[model samples]
Target: MSKDNFLKGAAILSIAGFLVKILGAVYRIPLANMIGDTGIGYYQTAYPIYTLMFALSTAGIPVAIAKLVSEKNSIGDYRGAQRVFRISFIGLLIGGVLTSSFVFFGAKFIVGKLENTNAYYALIALAPALLFTPIMSAFRGYFQGRQDMTPTAISQVIEQIARVGIGLALVAVLLNLDKGLPMAAGGASFGASAGGFFGSLVIIYIYMKRRKKIRKQIRRSEKFEKEDTSKIIRNILIIAIPITIGASVVPLFGAIDVAIVMRRLQDIGYTQKEASGLYGQLTGMAQTLINFPQVFSVAIGASLVPAISTAFARKNFSEIKKTATSGIRVTLLIGLPAAMGLFILAEPIIKLLYFSNPLEVQESAGSILKVLSFSVIFLTLVQSLTAILQGMGKAFIPVRNLIIGALAKVVIVYVLTGIPGIGVKGAAISTIIAYVIASFLNLRAVRKYAKIRFNLMDIFLKPVLSVAIMSIVVAITYNIFEGFIGLKLATVVSIGFGGISYLFALLLTSTITSKDFELLPGGTKLSNKLKKIGLLRR
Candidate 1:
């Protein structure tokens, strides 16, 4: 695929990602109110286990298959590519089934074993989504590797829509049926399984439709070469397994934290209920809020994997370096200002969105949000760098970094949670500290081991400047809107204005140049489309 194709893919995926994230946040705000922090805690508490297993089963394989398939196809090796796809899909299908069973049937034991019992039923609801998520992801990787963003992007939106729509409806219905808040929240979270089922079906339809098109292309051409199916499977697994393991560590740390930190909190002085509420705030509220900006980072990072892998496979070191630098730069460009905005506006944001809920621990939610905000920059950087290293095929380095971070987190949480004043703040501190360690380790490894170096100035300065401008604009807009609009509406409007103004300022200042725009997925096509639609200045 050409650079233009990359840009087009990025643009579509980025927009889809933005929509999904926005819808996700909007859905969560009410859902948080519906479930309260305690319910959210229960919901999130079970999620890490689900997330890790999901990652182990399918995370690395899809990208590996996509990279391998794309590379093989580029070299006109259709037989090898076809074999790789089939094997990876079957492996994921099996893994998905086992995970779903383990999560669903074992929910009672898992919840009973947990320090917090409030989250047990939520785990039950979430199990099916765990089963189907990998299957959907596999198809996404297949299409993405083929350099088609339409299906992948569309499916993400459809999944979120299904999730938000079904989740809200179900939660309301369950609440009315006199289910407790936590149980209702669990019901909401469980809707992900339904969404996953539907989303996977949508992608399957796309794949079936495209499969015929590809077959026709193959029949008309004689350029394709076949390979042994077993060899292809082995090669795909070799590349995919390490990546899957590495990709899962950060989330695994999070899941382990729910078990470890919640238990520690109870051991120190808190009641089971209080501890559950606190854990919920940290994971469900603060972490979820922090995740909003991460959507951009993740979407960009996901696109970068294939982009960098393609470049590296062809030995275009400079292009690989450029993509790496751009990916990190773009992450910070979006993340820093978001972190700052959250830090400054944490209380209002949290209160405005979640305060109406009757959850027991709402008063202290602001502190939770603030503590988590500090980790966003580090988390975003770590995420982007992890993807870059993986793309360079130095996937083990990220795993090592995560191991170090996880070890640090365990030690820090143990000491800090026992202290007189810290309590759940210890977990937040551990997360930030771990992310710092992981981010630096990842960057260093990429430089030392991969012989990859990003331009420091390009990565840091332009993005920082862009964020500064955005922050200033946001602050001004928030103040201007405060008197006219109610608190929540004012907050929302100010944020909307801030985002638009920031992008505008970035373009005006040339922080993100025309070339940068052109290099983005569908930059030229989007620009032209915008111009045609009169959204861009002539």
Candidate 2:
């Protein structure tokens, strides 16, 4: 893939990811307001079970397809590419049904292990989502494999929109009906099914619209016969199994928090309600807030998956090095400032967004966010690095690293969370620790396999310096304005000011240049304007 096109693809997905996240925040902030901490606990506890199922049925197969298809398309084997998609889609659908059934029929047993029996209704409500999510994800993976990020981006926004609107509407309905928190939480959980169904429709519609064109293209390229179905499935399984195992391990972080945190707290003599509230603070509040900042890394990392696959297929080591290096640099450039800003403004931001929640809950959540904020840098690094490894056909490396991290997290959570003074904050700490370990291992593997040397200046120092400057701006902006506009409005203004200042800081340090912005939509025009004003390199 061309560098410019690759970066542009990442930008498209990044914008879409950010928009989806904003919609999520808009939904969940209000949902939290309506449900309170206990209700949030139920919602979050149930959500992970859905996420686990979604990951299992969807994660490994699409990735395997994406890589396989990219290799086929790179060689002008469009027929082979289409065959891979057909096979993977069928497999994904079957897997989706089985996984969905497991969750639907086994909700009680699953939640029993999670130590959150109140999530039973939520899990039941969410099970249908697994049926469609794998299908939606399969289509997304196929499109991404073709390097057409637009369809996937469009589907993401539409999916999140359906989720937010339907979720809140159901939440309002169930609450108005005087249903208890569990049933009301289940209403909110059903939004995942609505979203997956709608998202699947969007992609299916797009695919149907493009079917004739794909067929026509395929007809023109009868270069080689398609591989046998068994061979294709075998190739797919080789890649998919490791990825599935790895991706499955990822949600286990949440599961670890779910299983360990509440029970550990209770073991230390905390009441069930208190332990549940703490769990909600970590998962419901902080986890939701942290997700928005990750769009940059997530977008670039996802784009890297297929891009790296193509490069690896062509034996283009220089291209792989260039792209992987760029991914890491960009991840850092965005992640550093995001983590610092979140750390600096964690309290006000949490309070501003979750205004309807009790002060105690909000404050407790703010503290959790502060500790978790630093993980932004580490986790984003892990994400980009893992993508690099996956694209280079080393999928199991990340799985091994992540599993090690998760094991460490299990130990940390067991030990730290039971401390009365430490409580749920320990879970946040463990997340960072896990990412630190995983990122280090992934980066080491990338360097060894890809034979790339990273410039600390580009990937680390400049970003750190820029973030240092931006943090001062954010802290001062909030402090100055809080006395006049109140903490909520001050938080808003500080964020606006902080964003602008970070841009200027980046420009002043030559940390980000015209070349980088040129990858974004309207970036060329913005670069021209910035150059004319002397803010960008000529």
Candidate 3:
């Protein structure tokens, strides 16, 4: 891939990613208020199971499809690419059905087996999402393979809008049903499934409209070949199965944590209701706040994968190293300050976002947020590193690292939570330790396979200093405006101010340059524009 082509792909992916993330946060905010922390607890309990199903059905296929299809198309193997797509669709359809079955019929058993039964209905409600998300993913992969993000972007925003509107409506109606909080929580889950169903339909419609012409073009092309359909089916399954298991380890570990913690808490004398409610506060309230800023890194990491895969296919090692390093650096740059800000401001933020609905959840939720804030920086680092290594075709390395981390987390959680004084705090500490270990392991894999060197002076010293300077400015401004402004709105304003200040400080300090940003995969034009507009003062 040429620099220009890579940039174009990155730009499109980043914009779509940002839109999707924004929608994710927007939907969550109102949903959190509607359901309260207890409802959120039930809602969150079902999430890991749903994520596991999503991973099972789609997992690594879209990525593999994106990589394989892009390579074949770039090398003039349109027939092979089309065959892969057809095979992917068939395989995903079967996977989706099986996953949905597990959720639909097994939800009660799964929930009952856990220490909590409050989330059983919510798990059942999310079953249809397991049915459709894989199919939606296949279409997304198809577009990504072609390096066209319009369909994906449009469908993503549309999906989120559907999710938020439908979810809010359901929650509101359920809240009024007098069926109580668990029912309201299940309503949110139902909304998610409804959103997925419609989102898949829309994407499928958009894809069919565009696909007919592509199929006709391929048929007319001299490059087209008549291949055995059976062979294509076998090849796709071979690629997707291992990728599914490998991709799902994180969510699987999460599900395990949910089950284990609930059981353990009950054994230690807490009621199921109390345990599940506490678990909900940890996942829904605390983790949600910390995760909001992480959307930036998640977007960057996700886009980096296909782009790196494409670069690797073209034997563009220079671009590969550059893109991978730029991705990690950017993740750290955005993630670290956000982590610090969250840790310092967790109380106010949680108070603002979750306090009104639950009433009694504010203090505990704030404490959980503080603990979780420490985890996001490491989580973002690990996430980005894994994406880079995986994109470089070093998938097993990340899998191994994740296993090591998961084991470490389990040990930590058992040891800490066993103590009389430490309860939910133990869980949060375990998560932090796990991600830190995972991040280091991922860093090692990147250094080993990608031959990327960490430059301490530039990557750590410069960005940290830039972010620190920005933090001081944010603290001052926040202190001044906090009295008049609510914590939620204050957080937004403070973060916006800090981000702008950090970029300016970086420019003035020569920590980053127009040339540096310009050399990034999809950043040349924007960098030049920034320089011209005096955004990069140095």
Candidate 4:
């Protein structure tokens, strides 16, 4: 694929990821309003466990499949690619079934470890998704490996639509039935399973539609050497296991939080209800908002793996360097502004999005969000660099780095959160510190493997400058407007102004060049338009 084609694929996934996150926000804000913090606690309690399991089951396989297939296809080993997919599919199916069975049967045992006994039903409700999502992920990985992101992007939107619509509807129905918070949350959890079911159906239909072409290609590849099944499975595991471990780090920390945070809060003398409420605010509210900007990073990371893998397979060092650098630069360009914006506008954003909550709850969430805002830059870096490492076939490096980070997080959480005044905000602080550690380690690994020289001026300094200018403008605009206009309207206006100001600063400083624009999806057209209007140089 052309460079532009790679970017276009990333763009499609990024846009879809953003839309999925928006739908998630819509689903979550309303659910938080309806169920309140304790219910959110119950719901969130089930999710981390589910995510950890899902990560083990599906996370690495798609990436491993994508990388393996891309490498095979790069060398014209079509038979090898098809064999990889077939073996991977069967393995994932068996693994998914096993994990789902464990989660379903061990629901009570799992919740017993955590403070939230009410989460048992939610755990059971989430079990079926574990079975379905891995199958969907296998298809997604196969297509992504082929450098076709359309199927994965379409499946994502379909999944999120199902999740939001069905989850909310179930919550409403359960509420009307006069079910308590735990049962209502359980109903919402069931919607997650429903969404996975629908998502699998969508991917299955797409696969069926394309089966004829796939079979034709496989038949044509019969002349190529065929690998043994055992070898293929071993290769898949070799690639998948490290990626799975790396991807599981964040969710593993989340699972740790589910176990530690509430119990610690109760130990600090808070009532069980109060402890759950605080945990709910930390995970359900603050973390939800924090995840929005990460959609872009996740998209870039996903796209980077296959793109870099192809280049690596071809032994194209320049392409690998260019792809990795561009990915990191784009991550900073998006992440810096997002972190700054969230830090500056935390309260206003919380009030705007979660207005249904009481004022004090909104205020508390806002404080937690402000502390969490610092994580955006580090998290984005970790993600982008991890992808680069994985693409370079150094998959185990990120796993090691993340383990160190997770250990740091555990210590920090134990010490800081144990204090009476710190409480939930300490968790946010520990998260930032953990990502900072992981990002640095990943950066060192990338520098060593990719041999990329630092270009601080272009990558880091310029974006930071532009973001600083934008933050100042936003703060001033908001301060002036807040005195006369309502908070919401002022927030909207200031955010608009800030975005425009940031763009202008980036252009005037040449922090972002026309060449940069040309690398993005539809960027060539945008560059041409800007040049025609005398906004961008020739």
Candidate 5:
């Protein structure tokens, strides 16, 4: 894909990701309030296993397939590309079944090891999604590799819809029936299974409908080279394994948190319920908000994989530079404001979302969120640069950096959480530091390999200035509106003003240029209109 098409693909995925995250926030906030932190603690404890499994089963191989398929398409080897998909799909299928079975059957043992036996049912409920998730991911990788993000995007949104609806329904029903927290959490967990099943069906149908067209392209290919399945598997694994390990680092930290944080909190003299509540506040509430911006990072990172891969395969150095730069720019443009916004409005935002909870719970969660907000920029940087490196066939560099960061997190959380009153807040601090180290290392890696010097004025200064301007408006807007309107409405309106002002600042300072706009779908026309309206420069 060309640079413009790359942006368009990112746009499609970002929109879908945005929807998914919103739904996720919708799901988690209600679930947290409904179950309270202790119930959410059980859910969150069980969740890390699903996330880690997800990273293992779905993350790496699909990216590997996308890169490989993009490479194959560059050389007009359509047959080899399809073979890569098939082989990878079958392997993922077997792995998913085995992995999900392990989780389902081993739910008690797994939750016991994590020290949250309350999550046993939740673990069992989520295990089935592992089977379906890999299937959905296989098709998603196939489509993404071919540079068609539509199917992946559409499927994700549809799946999230199902997940939210069913998850909420099950949780509500289970809770209403006076079933135990474990069962309620399990009901919520099963929503993922339902969503995955539906999502798999959607993507599979899309593939079937497009199979004829795919074959038509295959037959018209300038070259058809059939590779041995063994070789294709090797190529896919070579690319996938490191990526999977790297992707699992963050989720692995979840397991780490489950293992370390609860024990540390209890050792520091908090009651079991209090510790669970604090854990829930940290993971279920703070982490849920942090994940909102991560969706965009993930969307951009996904697009970058194929963009850089296709460009690298064709030896198009300039395209690589352009794509990498855009990734960085977009990362900054979005990341800066997201992190800043969260920092500025942490308490209000949390209170607005979790108003059903006691004031102390809301306050505690907001404080944790404030600390976690800065991690957004660092995590986005790590994600963006990691994608660049992975696209350049240096996937392991990121995995190494992230692992190093994860280790540091373990030491930091252990020490910090051991302190009286530090507890889960310390866990939040550990997360930020881990991302900072990982992102710094990633940036260094990108510099050493790609030699793409980021222009400070374009990428850093512009975003910083835009966010500085935005921060002023947001702080003022929230403060001014809070007294006049109610708290939630004020928070919402301030957020609305923040978005408007941030865009205005971008346009006003020309931080987002006509060239940048041209990279987006219909961006040229939008640019022309902006120029006509005196909001854009030549």
Candidate 6:
């Protein structure tokens, strides 16, 4: 794919991922209020297990398939690409079924070991999602490998729309029935399964519609070598396993925290109720806010994989360098401003988002969010660099780095949370340290493998300066508007001003130029308009 095509794919996925993150916030915030923090604790406990299983079952397989297919297609081996997909599809199907069964039948045992028996209902409800998501992922991988991002983007929005609508509706209905927290949380979990089912159907429809064209390509290809099914399967596994392990790192740490956090809190003299509530505040509220900014990184990483893989297959080192540099630059551009915004507006953001919650809950969550905000940049770097490494066929490097980071997190969480006054703040601090270590290690690996020179000024300094300007403007605007309007309206207006200020600062300082805009979807027209308006320099 050309650079324009690569940017277009990233832009499409970024927009879709952003929308999905918004829908996710819509689902989580209301669900938190309806179920309360303790209920959110139960819900979050089950969620980690589901995500870990998801990482193992679906995450790496799609990436592996995408890489394999892209490599084969780059050389005109269309038949070989199809064979990879076929074998991967069957492998994922069998794996998904087994994992789903394990989670469903073993739900009680799993949650029981974590000392949160109430999570069992939610676990069981989430099991069916596993059955469908792998299938959807296979179709998405196939399209993405061909450098087409529309299917993945469209399916994501559909999935999120279904998830929010069905999840909220189910929770509301179940709450009226007074089935208690576990059952209500279970109902919400069932909505996820429902969404996955709908998403799978959408992808299936897309695949069927394009099947004739896909087959035509396969039939038209001549003088191409084909690999046997077993060899294709082996290649898929070789690529998939390390990627799966690296992807699972975060979820594995999350699962560890689910088992450790509340139990340790209770061991430190908090009651079971207090422990669960605090855990909910940390994971449900603080972590949810942290995830909002991660959408951009995830989108960049997803787009980078196929682009870099295809470039690497063709031994196009120049394209690889350009793509890697641009990916890192874009990641820093988005992540720095987001982290600064979250830190500056942590309390107001918490108050606005969780206004329905008690003042104490909001305050507690706000404090945790302040600590978590620092993680945005590091986590974003870790994600982007890991993708670059994966594209370079050094997938195992990230797995090792993340494992080391996770170990540090576990030790730090244990020691700091055990302190008399620290409690959940320790977990937040530990998260930052973990990501910092992981990101630094990943960056080193990227530098070693890709041999790309880092321009510190372009990546960090300019963005930081722009964010500083934006922060000052935002603070002034918010303070002035607070007296005229309420907190919510003031917060909204201030954020709008901050975004605009940041953009103008970047433009004025030449941090963002016409070239950057040209990299975005619809960017050529936008760049022209901006140039006409004196906002962009040619």
In candidate 3, list every pair of residues with a backbone clash.
Answer: 7-522, 41-280
Task: Give the per-residue lDDT digits (tens) of candidate 2, residues 1-538.
Answer: 8989987887788788889877876677788888888888888888876777788788888878888888888888888899899989999989989988998999999888777788888899888889988898888888888888898999999999998889889999999999988898898999988998999999999999999988987887759975899999999999888777987987889878877887888888877767777787788888887877676677677778887899999999998887787778778887788888889999998898888888998888999899999998888899899989989889889989999999999999889988888988888999999999999999999999998988888778887888888889899999999999899999999999989988888889888766556334576799899999899974
Per-residue accuracy of model 6 over 209-307 as CA lDDT, tens digit each: 999999999987656655778888888888788778877999987887887787778778987777778888889888888888776678778768877
Q: List the global CA lDDT of all models.
A: 0.79, 0.85, 0.78, 0.87, 0.87, 0.85
Candidate 5, 1-538: lDDT as tens digits:
7989987887798789788888987689888878887888888888887998888777889888899989988888887788888898999999899889999899898777666778888889998899999999999999999999999999999899999999989999999999977788888889999999999999999999999999987887766656788888888888888767877887898988988988888888887778878999999998888888777677778768887898888878888877888788888888899999999999999998887888999999999999889988988888999999989999888889989999999999999999886778899899889989998998888877776777889888988999999999999999999999978999999999999999999988888877666435577899899999999975
Predicted candidate 3 versus true structure: per-residue lDDT over 1-538, tens digit per residue: 6778766766776677777777776666677777776677788888888987788778878877776677767767777787788788877888889888988999889988875688888898898888878888888888788887677777777777787788889889978878887888888888778878888988889988887878875765556565677876665667776787778888976786786777777777777777877787888778767667667677767777887898988878888887877777778777888888887677777777665655567787788778878787888898888888778888778778888988898888877765657777788898999889989988987887777787887778888898789889888878877887866777778878888898788887767754446434557777777779777653
Give model 3's TM-score versus the native structure: 0.87
Better of 3 and 5 by TM-score: 3
Question: Where in model 1 is the C-alpha error above 4 Å?
Answer: 1-15, 67-85, 141-149, 206-232, 299-330, 358-360, 387-392, 446-538
Question: Which pairs clash inside model 6?
Answer: none
Q: What digit string (tens of lDDT, one per residue) describes model 4 on residues 1-538?
A: 8989987887788888889878886687888888878888899999999989999888878988999998888887777898898889998899989999999999998888787788888899999999999899999999999999999999999998888888889899999989988998898888879889999999899989998987777667636667889888888888788778777888998987887888888778888777777888889988888888777778778778987898989989888887888888888888899999999999998888778778988898899899999899999899899898989999888888988989999989878887999997888898999999999999998888887887889889989999999999999999999888989999999999999999998888777766566435577789889888878864
For model 4, what is the C-alpha lDDT against the true structure? 0.87
Q: Which pairs, if any, clash in model 2?
A: none
* lDDT-better candidate, 1 vs 6: 6
Q: Where in model 3 is the C-alpha error above 4 Å? A: 1-10, 64-87, 142-148, 207-215, 218-230, 302-326, 450-453, 476-497, 519-538
Cα lDDT for residue 94, candidate 6: 93
lDDT minimum window of 10 residues, candidate 6: 513-522
List the RMSD of every prediction in angstroms.
4.8, 3.8, 3.6, 3.4, 3.9, 3.7
Q: How accurate locally is residue 132 in candidate 6, as Cα lDDT from 0 to 100? A: 88
Better of 3 and 6 by lDDT: 6
For model 1, how big is the CA root-mean-square deviation?
A: 4.8
Task: Give the TM-score (vs. native) of candidate 6.
Answer: 0.86
lDDT tens per residue, model 1, 87-167 = 788888888899889988988888777787778877888888977888898888878878888998989999989988898
